[model samples]
Target: MEEFIQEAYSGIFEKELVKEIAETAALIDFEEGDRLIEINDYIRSMPLLLNGAIKIMREDPDEGELLLYFLEKGDTCAMTLACCMGQTRSAIRAIAENKGSVVMIPVTKMEEWLGKYKSWRNYVFESYNKRLGEMLSAIDNLAFMHMDDRLLNYLKEKAKVNNTTVISSTHQEIAYALNTSRVVVSRLLKAFENDGKIKLNRNNIEIIAID
Candidate 1:
């Protein structure tokens, strides 16, 4: 785990600080579909993903939930940091998309690191910037793009994050992530199939091309 952190977070912090993190941080592993954070959960530690990916989602009381973005290797959850700093409950959910490991820093250590290490401060700021940009992109897709375009973009993003063009997701799962009905998702997927944009099978979608 120490070697893993040294490799994953190389150049992000100085050697001494890295050694401190390696010594103090708790290493944890997760399987796919495991919920790392849930709405209304109190977040006391900040997680830095070391391997695989996690999907962040925002819940709506009336509309189910929407996929906000993904946190891959070396990425940390900005919202988790914010919630911990403010001593507030988590408003978003983070689920492991595949088997992965993360190093969790306690809230107290996180605060101490920010004041003690310049690189730690920069990392927090950069995480905020990146997550904000992703949130804006998600908002643009929902507000400006049509459903077909949004669906295609969503699939493309999933493929990109998974490092494959073939996405192993069902129409219903896609609909839930996009905050739409399954029937609508199926209809649009069928349209994409007819247009040769994708090939659909049970519980999977193979993106043939994107125009």
Candidate 2:
């Protein structure tokens, strides 16, 4: 865990604080399709992703699920902190996008670290800032972008975050993330393929071009 943190979060935290975090944090592994958190679930520990990616989704009771952003290596989940610190249940969901490990810090430790370590406080605020910016961008995309553009942007973001040109996902999965219908997603994807923007396979899409 320490070694992973050193590679991912080296300059963000002090050595001693990192050591303390390593001592208290539980090392947990998650597979590709695992749900790290669910709706209305109590957050006992806030996760700091050590490797791979976790997609954070916002679920509406009536509107269904929408992918908000991702918490990748060296990133923290601001929503988790908000829920845990407020003593409230989770309103969003977190799922592992790939197989990876996370360092879970207890809620008590989160509180203690706020006052005990300056680096911890800075980290938390930085997380809040970053997440808020991403949320704003999501809003912009939803409000102003067309479905094809939004879908393309989503695929590009996914590819960039995963560090791969090929994205393994189904039409239904893409539909769920974008809060649209599978048929609509499939149609747009086919159009993209015809336009030489992407190549569609059985369950994966290889991005050929973004522009």
Candidate 3:
């Protein structure tokens, strides 16, 4: 675990901090589609991604789920940080985008290290800033971008996170992420296929012309 921590976060965190994290954090593995955090759940620990990607999503009872952003290697969820600091329930859901592992640092240690380690403090603040920008971008996409453009961007992001051009998700799953109907997603996907941006597969969408 210490070796993994050193390999994943060596340059980002100081040596002493890394040692402390290895001593204090618990490593957990997750499979694709696993729910790491759920809405309204009390967040007990924060995750530091060592491998793979996690997609952060917002859910509304009436509007449904919306994908906020993807957290890859060397990234931590800022929303989780906020919940830990405020001792509040999670407002967003975190799902594994692929098979991965995370070092879960307890909330108690999160605050303790904040004052003890400079690198930890910087990481926390940077995470907050970065996540705030992503949330704002999500809002901007909904308010300004057309659904097709939004869908294209979503596909590109998904492809990038999973490290493949092939996205192994159903149309209905895409619809849920975009907070739209499956029919709408299908229509737009067919249009995308016709436009040579993607190829429709049985269960996955393959990127062709799309970057």
Candidate 4:
């Protein structure tokens, strides 16, 4: 676990801080679709991604789940940091996008390190800024872009995070992430296939054009 932590976060964190994290953090593995954090759940720790991807999502009463962003290796969720600092329940849901592991650092250590470690403080602030930008981009997509364009962007992002051109998700799963109907997603996917943007498979999509 310590070696994994060092390899993942060595340059981002100082040596002493890395040692402390290795000693204090719990390493947890997750499978695809596993919920790491749920809405309204009290956050007791923050996750440092060691491998794979985690999807951060927001739930709307009427629209259901909407994808906020993806956390890749060496990243942590800014929302989790905020909730930990504020001592509040999670407003978003975090699900494992694939089989992976994370080092979960206790919330108690977050503040202590924030004041004690320069690297930790910089990481926290940078995470907040990056996540805020992503949130803004999501809002722009919803308010300005067409559903088809949004869906295309979603596929591109999913493919990038999964490190594959093929997306192994059903149309319904894509619909849930985009907060749209399966019928709508299916129609757009067919149109995308017709336009040479993607290839439709029985249960997956092969992206041909991504920009």
| Higher-ranked by lDDT: 2 or 3 | 3
Instruction: Estimate the overall C-alpha local distance difference test score of candidate 3.
Output: 0.93
lDDT of 1 by residue, 29-112 (tens): 999899989999999999999998999999998969999999999999888999999999999999988888999999999999
Which residue runs does candidate 1 get wrong by more than 4 Å? none
Total clashes, candidate 4? 0
Q: Residues 47-104, candidate 2, lDDT per residue (tens digit)?
A: 9989999999998777678999988899999889999899899989899999899999
Candidate 3 residue-wise lDDT at 152 = 95
TM-score for each prediction?
Answer: 0.96, 0.96, 0.97, 0.98
For model 2, the local distance difference test gives 0.91
User: Candidate 3 versus the native: TM-score?
Assistant: 0.97
lDDT per residue for candidate 4 within 96-197, as digits (tens), equals 999999999999999899999999999999999999999999999999999988998999899989999999999889999999999999999999999998
Q: Which stretches of candidate 3 lie over 4 Å from their true place?
A: none
lDDT of 2 at 81: 92
What residue pairs clash in candidate 3, if any at all?
none
In candidate 4, position 174 carries an lDDT of 92
lDDT (CA) per prediction: 0.91, 0.91, 0.93, 0.93
lDDT of 3 by residue, 1-211 (tens): 8888889887889988898889999999999989999999999999999999999999988969999999999999999998988999999999999999999999999999999998999999999999999999999999999999899999999999988999989999999999999999999999999999999998789999985
The Cα RMSD in angstroms, rounded to one decimal, for candidate 3 relative to the true structure is 1.0
Residue pairs with backbone atoms closer than 3 Å in model 1 (clashes): none
Clashes of each: 0, 0, 0, 0
